[model samples]
Target: MDAWEPRPVPSVTPETEPFWSAAADGRLLVRECPDCGLVYHYPSALCPDCFADAEWREASGAGTVYSFAVQRHLGYWPEDDLPVVFAYVELKEGPRMVTNVVGCRPEDVEVGIPVEARFVPTDEGGIGVPVFVPTEP
Candidate 1:
C-alpha cells in the first residue's frame, strides 16, 4: 500500500478551537442545541435548525460510512497517495462529517461499514485532525 501524503493543517478559528482541542486529546466533539436536541458538526455558536445556542458535547467516535469516493488523481498530491478514500461518516450522535477513511486499503471501504474515529496530529504542533478506520470485526 502507498503511504499517505502529509495532510494540510487546518486553520483553527474561535468557533472551531474547542473541537480541535478535544481532538488533540483523542476525543471527538459535536455541537448540540439544548432546545431542539439537534446535533451537528463543523462547530458553530448556534444551531442550524432553530438558531438556538449550541453547546459542545463529546461524541461517541463511532459511526457508519454514509458515502465515499476514491481519489485516483490530484495534481498536488503525490502518486503514492493517489487513492485516498474520502468519506462522510454518520456519527452515532446523529450528524454526518466529511473526513478521510484511513488505516486500510482504499478499495476496501464501502457504504454502511462500521468505523471509529482516530486523531492524526499535524506538523508543527498543530491540532489533531479526525479520520476514521474500519472497526474490528
Candidate 2:
C-alpha cells in the first residue's frame, strides 16, 4: 500500500479563481451579492437567492461547524487519506462551505464547533488550498 500524500498544488478554475487566488495570498473569500445582500460559498457568479451577479471579497475566516461526516473511502480519488472529515462550515457572514476539517482528529469533530480557514502551503512553500480547522474562542 502506498502512503497517503497531501495536496501540494492549488486547484483553481474560472468559476472559483478568485477564491483560490485569495486563499493563496492568505485571505479567505465569501460570496456577497449587491443585488440582494446575500452571501454564499462554492462561489457562483450569480447569486443563488436573487440570481444577480455576485462578487468575492475577503471573509473574516470565522465560522462554525454546522455538520460533518467521516469519509472512509476515496471513491474516485483513491489516494485520499482515510478518516477524512467532510464538514459544512457556516461563516458568520451568512454563508457556508463544504470543505475538509483539518488540524485534528475526525472522530473529535462535533456540530457547532467553531472553526476557521487555514491555508496549507504548496510543495515549494507557495500558497495552496484552504482547509478548515477548529477555531479558538
Instruction: Write down the lDDT of every candidate, Cα atoms only.
Output: 0.87, 0.76
lDDT of 2 by residue, 78-100 (tens): 45466688888898887888888
Q: What ranges in model 1 sit over 4 Å off?
A: 1-5
Total clashing residue pairs per candidate? 0, 0
Tens-digit lDDT track of model 1 for 1-137: 22122646678998898888888778999999999999999898999999999999999999999999999887765666668889999999989999999889987899999999998775535477899999965
TM-score of each: 0.91, 0.80
Report how far residue 1 has shifted in candidate 1, in Å. 15
Model 1 shows how many backbone clashes?
A: 0
Error of 2 at 85 (Å): 0.8
RMSD of each: 2.5, 4.0
